[model samples]
Structure formats: structure tokens, C-alpha cells
Target chain A: MKVYRLRIAVQAISFIILIYGGLFYIDMGNRMPTFSCAYVDDRGGGCFLIGFQHMLSRPFGEFLGDAGIRLLKAMGIFALWSIVLNKAWCGWICPFGFLQDMLSKIRSFFDVDLSRFGWITRTRYKSVKYIFLVLLILIPLGIANSFFGLEKIPRDWSVPFCQICPARVILPVFNGDFSQIHIDFSSNTTMVLTTIVMVLVALFFTTAFVKRRFFCSYCPMLALLSLFDKIGLLSLKKNGQRCTRCGNCSRACPMEIREIEEEKVLTNLVTQDCTLCLRCVEVCPEDKALETRFCGIPIFTASQQGFLKRQGLDEESHTNKNGA
Target chain B: MIKTVISCFMALFCLFPALATAKAAQPATFMWLEPMSWDAIRAQRAKKKAAITKVTGGQQEAPNPAESYSTSQDKGKKRAARGARPRSYYLHSGEFPQPDRQQSGRPARMNGQYNHRAKPKKSQTQAILWVKYPDNRSLSFAPKQRGPVSLFSFPAGDGGWYDLFAYHDQGVNNDSRIHRYSYTHFMSHGDSVDKHETNGIEGPGFFKGQPILEIKRLCADDHECYRTHAGQNLRVQVSFKGEPLANQTLTLITEQGWKQSKRTDDHGKVSFLLIKELFPEKIDRRKSENYLLTTEHVLPATGVLNGQPFHHEHHIATLPLQVFPPKSDWQSKRMAYMVGSGTFLLAGGAIAIRRKRQRKAL
Candidate 1:
């Protein structure tokens, strides 16, 4: 649990710092300062790879900056993380996911339990999240001069996320100054009121009806991360022998995966949404039954059956000595 | 752990900026020899007319070619024959401005002319140009005939062949009456293939064949940079092909009454440069949008090449272009509104719908 919290905090901070440094630290004019964090200007989504804008032309072809084409390289890095952590980013570090988490919590205050519906609920809902992501990422990509023409889709689509995003609205307010930051709006409407309304409504429903993470099931960012989780590196291991009928871990699991004590596999067998939050591990009294490993290295010191057996033997020795 | 953190932090601080600065360094690598914007040129505080006059000084003057021809004719036939390159530019008046370097952008000349070092020597087959006079000073003069100009050239290697080229003095307005220069001589290389070496034989050039370069004199009336690209003339062309035959220097005599031999391009095409003229508004039924005056080098004769016998026939190509001065009128505004609004609604509406569906799904 300690490891998971520390790692999540580290990743979140690193991501913010990368953007801040790129935007605030440099002042070279006319020179595109390398893969821009100015999500507003997607030279080419692949611009990440090129590092700079190169004016390339042929007898004929579409021309774009390297920004977006650069992000395609992110897939390889994403796959490496998946091999280790699954969709842990979506569940934990993703600011968008985190926003939805806050919303669901607000809902809990209103008594809404979102996780009541099971897999049998409906298959139609599954397509919604993917559809949203395609609209957000791809449609703008296809049009030469559509509305998504020049700006980012994230700030506009993730209304709730941006509304409370500390990087944009809150950080400047808290910092007491905003002369350095420059934000270009892609959407036409003001967000402060809209975000308030949505958050309030979310809070009302969260307490009244649905599960805390229900909105996440349809989150585009989670959906993308899930694709990475398919080949993750870190995994949860379960020992079958010492397993009792304790449903404690499963009940505490956030994404509602079934296997806590018995559902162990050689690899990560849960959904890509496994956050590595270790809430299940913390709840399990017999921690020896479950273990966390990275590429087979003991990341979390697990209490195994062998160690417990040794302890039991040591106790017997002590009692005998005392009685004798 | 501290060391590792320090190294990571150092890498973080240094790496991205290094990568960024490295690419930024490239723009500095290639120095821009030419000015990028008009503001830059304007900021140079260059006087338009003075700069242009230097490029054209007395180069286009024909010394009153008609007067010289008249004097020779009256002075007896011997002197008339000596007046070989007489040109009558008195016909062009008020249509163009006085030649000045500042008014018209000047072509960058290394010594005096871009092709002066590349000039070939004299030969019989080569069309040797003799400029009788190099300055013309008439803003408006009426000409009896507005027809094609003749050009001449010779074999490239043996000397005596020179390609004819013309450039308008920059900064000048649409008045083309400025005297135009003409060169009447050059040499010819035996083979048509390989002429890039002809320039005063400058260290054996990389290519071959004397190319017939079509120097189009774009007048300032053009939309892009009428000020920069166009000077006074609308067009100028050079060609040496035909029924009369491209003699030494690929010269041809125009049957449309022009007796001077004209040079033809390697592809047997004629070259011309013209400052596209603003045509009379289309108010009249015959309103010309633009007047593009162009002329094709009509082949005077042809039979066979290398053994294939084939007869050829021809006609002179056009020299004048139709110019439609973009008029700011009610009809134009109406058309813009019709097209612009329709397109905006259709394109924008489709985008909005696609977005709505996507948002709902999300």
C-alpha cells in the first residue's frame, strides 16, 4: 500500500512538472521548443517523435508537424508500463480518472451506489466509451479545418476534469498570480458554472445510486489505458493452499473484480483497471495468501505460508520452554 | 539514492533544452540572402526608382530606332542596310513608367549581367546581337504593329550564340513604355543536347545545350507582388523555329512582317515574357478581363530528323493574356456571400453533428 501511494504521487508530479518546465522556462520565439505540452496546438500528434517541426514536402502529400506522430511512440512506453502495472494509470494517476473519482465520491455523499449493475446489465453501454474517445481523438485528426481543427479536444470534452484542474484554474488562484500562464480556450462556453452544476449533480447521484467508480467504466482515458493493461508487468499472485472463504479482499476491490484469494493466475488475470491500489492486500488478514511482484521480484514483503509455519513452530518451542 | 536523483534531475534540466536548442540552431545555419518580407525591404529605405534605373540604365534604349531607320532610308540605301537592328518602341506610351531600379526590383547581377560571363563568341551560324541603342524614354507611344518580337542565337560551343533575356526595372508602376533592351547575337554548339557550358566557358559547366529561357516580364499588376515581381512590361518571349528554318543560332524570320531572325528553344518552343496588362473592364460586351500578349515561334519549315522524313506546318502562338482586374462590385459581393455562407453552414453543421453524437456516447 505504501509503495502504490508513493509511485502514484511520483508519476502525477512528474507529469505536471514536464508540462510546467516546457511552457514556463523557455522563451525562444519562432522556434517550436520541441514536443509541445501546449495540447492546444497539435502540430501533428506525432510531433512527440520529431522533437521539432521540420518542413518536409514532396511532389504531393498531406503535411503536418511532428507533434502527434510523436505520441505514437508513447504506445511502446505504455505497453512497458502495462506489462508491469496494468491500467494502473487510469485508476490512480490519470487526472481525468481522478476527476471522475472525485465525482463518484461526491455521488456517494448523495447516497447513489453506481456499481449496483453487473455484467448482465447491458452490452450497449460498452460501445459508448470507445465512441467518445474516437470522437475526441480521431475526428479532429481527419478534418483539415474542422472545429477540432486547431485546438485540443481534452479541455473541451473533459469538462469536469478541466473545471477543477489545479494546473489551470486552481493553481493560478492558489499561487496568487497568473502572468506567466497562457491558456487558449478551444470551447466557446464558460466552464466554472457548468463544472459546479455537474459536480453537484454527481454528488447527488453518487450518494443516492451508483458505485463510486461507475463513471470510470466509461472514461475514455481508462479505455485507452485498458488497452495497455492487456500485457502488463506487475501482477497479483494468490496461493491456493492457505486460501479461506474470506471475501474481504474482493469486497474492497475498486473495479469490482471477483478473484481476491482464489482468482490467481501466472499473469495479471484481472481487468486492465487494476490500480495496484493494494486495498485488497491491506484488508486481507492472512497476507501470506496474496503477494505483489514485479517481473517476479517481491515488491511488497508478503507474509507467506512458509514464514507463518516457521513462526508457528517458534511459538510452540517458546510454550514448551516456558511449560518445562 | 541522492546521486541518482541528482543525475536524473540534471538530465531533466539539460536534455530537453539541449534537444530544443540543437534544432533551433538550424535556422541560423542557412543565412537568408534575400529579404523575407516587404516590410524588410521597405525598412532598408531603398529608393525604388534609383535602384531600378541602375539595373536598366540605357540598356533598353533604341536611340529612336525609327528615327535612325528614317535617316538611313533618306541618306541613301547603303546606310539603311547598316541600320540592321532598328526597333520602333515609340508606339508604347503612357502604358508604362520611366525605367528606374527603385520602382522595379532588379535581378541580382554578379558583374553587370547575370549571363555576361556566359556569353559566346561570333560565328556565321551564331546570331550575334548588336544593340544599336540601350535606352528608351517614352511613357506612351502608339505603334503601327503590335506583333511578335524576333530573336536569334548560334551553336553554343563554337561561340557566337547568346540567349535573349529581359527584366523589367522593379518599383515601376504598370506603365510599360520604358525602353526595352534587345541583344542580337550568339554562337551554336553542334549538338542540341548539352549547352549549359556556354557561359564564357566558365570552368566547364555541369550540363549541356543552350537553353532557350523564356523571360516573362511580370508587370506590377500581378496580385502576389505586382510591386516586387511585376515592373512595367507584361510579357517577353524568345523562339527560333519554323518553315523558313532555324538558321545559324537557330534564328527565324517572322513572316508576320518581322524580318529579323528569331532563335528557337531546344524543344523548338518559343520563349516570351510579358507584363500581364489590365484589360478594359467587362462593362462592354467585349470587355477583356486581362490582356495577355504572347507569341509562339511558328515553324517556317520542316521535313525530317536524322532520316525520318515528315513534313511540318505551323502558326504563330498568342502573346496577349486576358486580364480580369478583380472588381469590387455588388455582383462580386453577392456571389461571395452566397458561396461563403452556404459552405460555412454545410461544413460547420456536419462537424457539429459529428461532435454531438460523440459527446453523447462519451
Candidate 2:
């Protein structure tokens, strides 16, 4: 539970860093030669996006150009983060997710759809994010391609989220240069639309509002992160026999990972997006039925064996040890 | 020769200051002009021909491959024709510069004519002008939008490769005379290898390809002319407006005395602080013979951009005064006479030596 608190604090800090990325954008994208903050002051001040993008395209060929190279570098950075931190970007730092979480908390809105839909809508639509990522990438290339067979210019590899991303489409329109809206017409339209849509969506699919805990249940990003979860550093274990199903863990689950009922204790194999956002362990009133750890190798209250035995569940940490 | 030289010198002297100060009060951006598809242009011509056919009322027949009005046509048919057709000559079909993109409503062809410094074959026909702006100031090349658009206006090309925009003044007048040295001052953004032509993260050369920007006097066709009459220290200045760049150290030296250096002043103006002092060539000849007088600036451009400031090397034309003492002023103009006489004799002696060598070969 203490770890949960710490994770929240860290998440907030990481959120600040993400905002720094934004400030850096407004900080440096304003100048030209496109992506190079190469000509900066002694402090080397500029956007992380621009500076980092410049670094990537360099090792490759010149066709990418310096600006194009920089953008490619930004992509490499994102991919690296996906491998290292898994889906943590979505959990703690995604500005879109941040907005979603804020909306999910409104106590006033309510809606019950008369139109019924199947659960299959779950896994299918989760694939949309990848499609969105692709769309964002291709649009710019397509435009360049039309002008002078500009097919040679590299695509926007970094911020793959920019393409058809509802987040950007819904918010203030920040230009490629990263300058903020003072009188940006696009920003005004997007702001009004996002606000109106947020209000409407909150009134309708209210459950869709939860944080890293909610839409992430089927988030393609989570699907990707889960693959890396095998080597992840955060996990949770439940003590069944000690589990007086007080409904506490279920109430506390941040990502809404199922916490109760089945006599068998199931460790979330897909915890890459877990972000160790430990709301589950904090609410467990059975004097600790659920516990958190690094890779399910206990670091908190007890070992995995003791908890499984108490639950009368027969599972071994063998596979976790195998790491395959 | 003397008359032509003096005329040229006088022209340089008169026009140099005029160019520096002659910018349009409200300058316009350069927009890309490109032609449409061959099919589209052909279709348009066909439509015009049809119009002419109708106006002629079945009189003169229109040619299929297309032809000039000067070629023999049906005169009696023309009399039968009710309306007269203004003469139209179809240009010979040949390769012309085109933009890569499909027609964006703008027709483009490289207008190297105004570019009096570009090489020959450049002005033969039109191609995409590729109006490349080194910075926003170069934005004049684009059509005036309400303001600057986020879009980059470039030529639409074919194949996999794309063409870049640059306007080189093709050197020659309709008379085929060498282009007048345009003392018409305008900033010349020095060319550098493209980013792709360079390495990433890895900085420029180390003892390999020379690092300095050799000051080149753009020839009639952008040829790099070296060693000249105006002295080697070709007073090169890097400036924004009229203000000189003084802070940065810019060195001009031959490989021999590469040690001497000069820095720009507070006004951002740097003068010739070179190791070798330049001596201008002195020459004299008959009044009407044209002379190929020239000059050189062996400069190397280098310096860290302390901030995000921008700069350019503007080769302001110095007065090409040959100091020809008119026949009226003799005694008082002794220095002019002596220098002019010495130059004429030296030139003659050099010519004589070459002739003697040629005679020996025969």
C-alpha cells in the first residue's frame, strides 16, 4: 500500500516531466531549420521533441535530412521507453489519459444505454490505437510525397500518438513549431469540441472514465506493454484464506484488474501497464490479503508461497523464475 | 580596350551603392511557377485550335502536328474565312523544366534569364525555378498567402528523386556579351553541402576536406575566378543590414600565411585582417579594347553561432577605378601615369614571352 502511494507520487512527477516536454515544445519549436534546436543558448535550451528527433535521423542516411532525422530519433526514444517502462506512459504521463481520469471522477453524470452491444467490441476496438498511430505517421508523408515526390522525406516517427489521436484532435492545436495558442483558430475549435464531447461522453459511457485502470482494460498500448510484462518490475499477489472477501481489494484496484472470488489466486500476467498503481493492496481490509512486489518476487509483506498456500491455491512461481 | 575597361569600371562604381540601397519598398515573396501536364497543355491548345476553326468558318485548315502561321496556307480559303486569326507560332517541342507535383495551378520554368550569373544552357528554356529561401526572408519566393503558410511550396517532380530550388543568374545578354559585373549589391547566401551530404552528430571535417569557405568571385557563369586586378584581399563583409559583423573572427589567408586573423567589430562587420596584403593589378591598353579585369577573396568562413542569429557574406563591389589620367592632366598625375605605364609594359612583356615560346615550338 505504501508502494502504491509512492507509485502515485512518482506518476505525478512523471506527469510533470511530460508537461516539461510540452513546455520544451513551446520552448523551442518556434524557430526554424525545422527540427534543430542545435543553435541554442549556452544552456542548450529547446524542446526534448526537437532535440531528441535530431539525434535519431543522424546515423541513418541524409535523405532523412537533419530535421527528419531528429524526428526519427524521437520515435526511437518512444520505442525505447515502451520497452523499458512498458505502458507506464499511458498510466502516469499520457496527457490524454490524464484528461480521461479527470472526467471519470465526476459524481454527477449518469447514463444507461438502451442500445445493447456485445463484449466482443472490447478486443476489436482496442486495435484502433495502432491504426491511429499509423494514420498520424502516414498523413505527413503523404502530403510531402505529393509535393516534389517528397517521398524521400522521413515520416514523423516520434509522437506516433499524434496521428488521428483523439487527444490532439480534441485539445488546443499546437503547431509543428510547438507555439501555444494565443489566438490560434484551430485550438479554439478543438477546445470547444473536446469540452462538449467530454461532457457528453461523461453523461453517457460513464464507466469509460477511469484512469490507467479503465479503458486500458482493452487499450492496445496495454496489450503491447503486457508483452513486456514478463520482465516487469511490479506485480500483485492475493492471500485467499487470509482473503475475507471484504470487497476491499476490488474497490482499490486502479487498473481494475480483477481481485476476488475465484478460489485460485491469479497473478496478472499482463502487468506491463500495471504501473504498480497499487490501489488494490491499500484497500484490502483482511489485514493484507493482497501484496505487491517486483516481478512477483515479494518485496513487501510476505513471500508468494505463503499467500498461495493460504488461498488453498496450487500455483508455482516456477514460470516467473523461468522468465520465458 | 581602355574605353571598355573604363566603361566597366565606371559602371561598377556607379551601380554598387545603388544595389545596396535599391530594395523594393515593399518586397514580394517569390512564388513557384510550374507548367501543367503535357496532356493538359495539349488539350488546351486543341481547344484553342477548335475556337480558331470555328472563327475561320471552314476556311484555312488547322495542322495536326501544329505549325507556324508563316508557313504557306490556303489564301483562297482564308478569303472564304469570315474572321481573321492573329498569327500564332507553335514552339518546337522539346524538354522543358517541370515541377514534380501535378499542376498546383502555378506554371513553373526556371527563369534563369534574370539570373544573369547562371551558366549557359540554363536560359535555353524554362524549368522549375526552385525558389529556395535560405530563411524566412527568402519567403518572397512563395505566393502571398494571407500570411506565411505552414506549407512549403516546392516543385512536384517525377521519378523517385526530387529537385531543389535555386536561381543561378545565367550569364549572357541577348548580345552574347559577358554579363556586366552586377555591382548591384544583393546578399549572397553562401552555399554549403546539404545536411544529407554531411554526417549526423559528427561535426564537419577534421583535416580532410578544407573547412574554410573560399571567397569566390562569381564569374559570368558562376565560375570561381581567382587572382585578379582588384587585389587578393577582396574586401568581403558579413552583415545583416548595413551593419557589419564585428565580434566573430574571420580569417583570410593563403596556405602560405594562414596565421594572420581578423575579427568582426561590434557592428558585426569584419574587414580584411588577412596575413597577405593584396595588391591590385594595374593595366593599360587602347581606348576601345575590352579587358578581363578580375579580383579574388581567399576567405574561409568559420565561427560558432553564439546565439540563434543569422548572417550572410555580401560581396559589395568596390569602385573598379583604373585611374586613367585623361590626356589633359599629365605632370600632376605622374603616379597614375607611371603605374599605368608600368602595368601596360608588364602585360606586353608577358605576352611577348608567350609568343617567343610559341615560335620556338614551331
User: TM-score of chain B, per candidate?
Assistant: 0.18, 0.18
Distance from true location, Cα of A178 in model 1, Å: 11
Q: Which stretches of candidate 1 lie over 4 Å from their true place?
A: A1-85, A99-116, A122-127, A136-138, A144-210, A240-242, A259-267, A301-324, B1-362
**Which lDDT tens digits does candidate 2 get at residues B142-178?**
2222221112222111112221221212123222211
Chain A: TM-score in each model? 0.53, 0.49
Residue B119 of model 2, lDDT score? 32
lDDT of 1 at B362: 90
TM-score result, candidate 2:
0.37
C-alpha positional error of residue B15 in candidate 2 after TM-score superposition, expressed in Å: 22
The lDDT values for all models are 0.35, 0.34
**Stretches of candidate 2 above 4 Å error?**
A1-8, A21-88, A106-161, A169-218, A239-244, A259-265, A268-275, A295-324, B1-362
Label model 1 with its docking quality class.
Answer: incorrect
Candidate 2, residue B343: CA error in Å? 86
What are the DockQ scores of the candidates, in order?
A: 0.00, 0.00
Model 1: per-residue Cα lDDT over A1-324, one tens digit each: 244356457545533543343345432211221111223221111111112111111101122212233233344544454455565554544443344455555766876434444555525466666775565444334322234345433323232322322223223322243321222221233223333333333333332233545555555555565665545566666665556747766776765656554564433444544566665665554656666666677665345333334344464565578799
| Cα misplacement distance, residue B7 of candidate 1 (Å) | 83
